[model samples]
Target chain A: MRVLITSGGTTERIDDVRGISNFATGSLGKITAEQFLQAGHEVFLLASETAILPEAAENLTIIHITTTDSLVKNMEKLVPEVDAVVHTMAVSDYQPVFMTALSNFSDDFSKDDLLHFSAEKVRKISSNSDFQLMLLKKTPKVISYIKKWNPQVQLFGFKLLAGVSEQELVDVAQKSLVKNQADFIIANDLENITKTQHEALLISFDRIVKMHTKLEIAQSILEKAQEAYHG
Target chain B: MRVLITSGGTTERIDDVRGISNFATGSLGKITAEQFLQAGHEVFLLASETAILPEAAENLTIIHITTTDSLVKNMEKLVPEVDAVVHTMAVSDYQPVFMTALSNFSDDFSKDDLLHFSAEKVRKISSNSDFQLMLLKKTPKVISYIKKWNPQVQLFGFKLLAGVSEQELVDVAQKSLVKNQADFIIANDLENITKTQHEALLISFDRIVKMHTKLEIAQSILEKAQEAYHG
Candidate 1:
């Protein structure tokens, strides 16, 4: 089987020098990719440039990406060719609508005054700390596009919820599974994910499988993918 | 001499699960702290927990901090005891005003509807991809408080600019010096800092000293601190 895995957090550029990104280390995704390759699957790792990855392997190919847009573009090109995709990238949902120079305004300026300034005026900001305003815009849902691009590919989506109960986590994961038409969704909460060992729930239409540790989760995902492929 | 150094980028929490932060590896600050310890200065490292640090030394003490408020609190306690302070932490200038669950809103909602929703209402969001809005509020400048807390400590502030000319970098550094009453400001642009070897301009009231490489920058800073203490 050929597997496409995405790890790390997507970064949205606010300006030439700065960006908005999440705190995904890509550790789990990298682990998953390596596990699949160890199981004799060819792997294409679409990863954030900041993510720490394993050393090169004969069956592994790495594609480094920076932003959500770039990730989408690469997925469009790669998903069709792969047998399965495990998308664990912490894609940013919002981006700065406009970036203003921190040096353009004084400390005393009101929010109204700041909001009134157009993106055109904000682009001229030159100084680092000129007191600026950045309005955030919602990014399109990338996972929702995966099945659209490749209906035959086995898709495993991820749902990360902070401070949520197990029931809530499963509910959210189910919604994602239905909405994205994913074969399964891996759901976990913040409290467990931050610990050395974590647990995740794998939800498909027929059953929910709970697995402890990242390794177990990855293995279970592969098992399900194999079942789907051989069935 | 007693040296107080701050490293890593401060993180501002958006909700129970997410945060906004800058891309500071704390490599430079960690190197500077190591250099100071090697030079026999008693060191207090108030650093972000995310930063990588040198191994423990008898002359060094580490205090982990996360947010700007935490950093400020630690500074208040440690600044008076140190002879010099090197503030290299990339403190966030803004924090999200509201954090709502992503499950509450539908995908079809308009931007105007989200904008009109009060923070109180938006706080009720539940799902992960429910399309949400986050408002950003300016954070108080932490550097401006250094002199007010300790009048005698030699303060070294850092100014990082991206895609700026050398002249612009120096101007921002000078402004920081005057405004914050810093003894010196180390100025560097993104283009140079991203390279294997980088240059920084040390801007003081009397002179501007240019140094190459992270080690040279750290050494120049300590040298200036020695001049301020003994001269």
Candidate 2:
């Protein structure tokens, strides 16, 4: 099977130099891609530039992406040719809301006057001793576009929740599966992620499968992909 | 000299699960700490947990910190004991303004009704399909507290400006030196940072010395510390 896997976290640029990003190591996706290749599958890995990966392999191809838009563009271009997708990338859901700079002078510049700029612009202003207000805008839902681009390709999504109970974790994962029309959703809590031993649940429409260790989860995901392809 | 150095970027929590952080790798700080140790100085490295570091040394002690508040707390405890401070950490200047969730929303909820909540509240709202506003509040300036905490320590601050000309970079660095009562300020442009080679200006009250590589900059900073300690 030809598979497309995205790993790591996407960054949203606040300026030419700085950006907002998450702490995803892309280890999960990298391991999963390696597992798929060891199982005799061709892999295209769309990974964040900062994500760490093992040494190169013959059956694997890697494309480094930095931002959410770039990830979308690559996915749109590559999804049609792949047989399945395992998207483990944490895409930013909000972009800095752009706002115009306000120019004025006075000890009493109203808070109302400062609300004109974005949190990003306010950060720039704060460096110069000027306190300003900032705003944010929501980014488009990237997962919802997958089926639009490739309806037949089997899709597996990842949902990470922090400080949530197991029931809440499963509930959210199930909602995500239905919303994205995904074949399976991998659910994990952040608290468990910090421990040496970790567990995750693979939620499909009819049942939930629990797996221990990231390597075991990756193997289970591959097995499900094979079933998806040959079923 | 007993030297204290800070490296990497601080993170500000946006919610229970997410945060705002910069792209600081702490490479510069790690290298500088190693250089200090090589110069026979006892070093205290206050670094972000995400920052990379070199192999362990007997003369070095590493304190891992995450947020600006944690950085401040560490500095307050260690500043008076150190002979010099090389603060290279990219401390976040803003934290996400958290908001309470609004309940009892209907399908016909008007946009005006949502405006009653804060921008932080709006960001939470936007996640569920009701687009709303976001606001940011400025974080306390961490550098400004250095002199207040320890008056006699020879302090070196770092200033990183993106897409700025040499004159602008120097001006900002010089201003930072005056504002913080810093002994010296190392200024660098972000555009030059991505290149194979990098350059920085050491701006003090009396003179500006330009250095060509990170290693050279680290060496120069150490020399300044030695001079301040002995002079």
Question: Best candidate per TM-score, number?
Answer: 2
TM-score (0 to 1) for chain B of model 2: 0.87
Candidate 2: lDDT of B134? 32
TM-score of 2: 0.83
Residue-wise lDDT of candidate 1 within B29-137, one digit each (tens)?
Answer: 8899989888889999988766878789999999998788899899999998889999998888766656443343453444344444455532123444433445455
Best by lDDT: 1
Candidate 1 stretches greater than 4 Å from native? A49-58, A99-117, A121-133, A162-171, A191-197, B49-63, B99-118, B121-134, B162-171
Off by over 4 Å in 2: A99-132, A162-175, B99-126, B130-132, B163-168
Can you give the lDDT of residue B177 in candidate 1?
Answer: 95
Taking the tens digit of each residue's C-alpha lDDT, what string does model 1 give over A74-176?
9999999999999999888776666554344443444344345466632123434423445565677889998999999999999887667899988999888
Q: Per-residue lDDT of B1-231 in model 2, one digit per residue for the tens?
A: 899999998887665544667668888998899899998999999988768886799999999998888999999999989899999999886665542322333433333333343443221222553232333456787888888889999999999876678999889998899999999999997767743566899999999999988888899999999998999
True contacts kept of 2: 0.26
lDDT of 1 at A27: 86
What C-alpha lDDT, on a 0 to 100 scale, does residue B5 get in candidate 1? 94
Pairs of residues at least 3 apart in sequence or in different chains that clash in candidate 2: A119-A134, B119-B134
RMSD of each: 5.1, 4.8
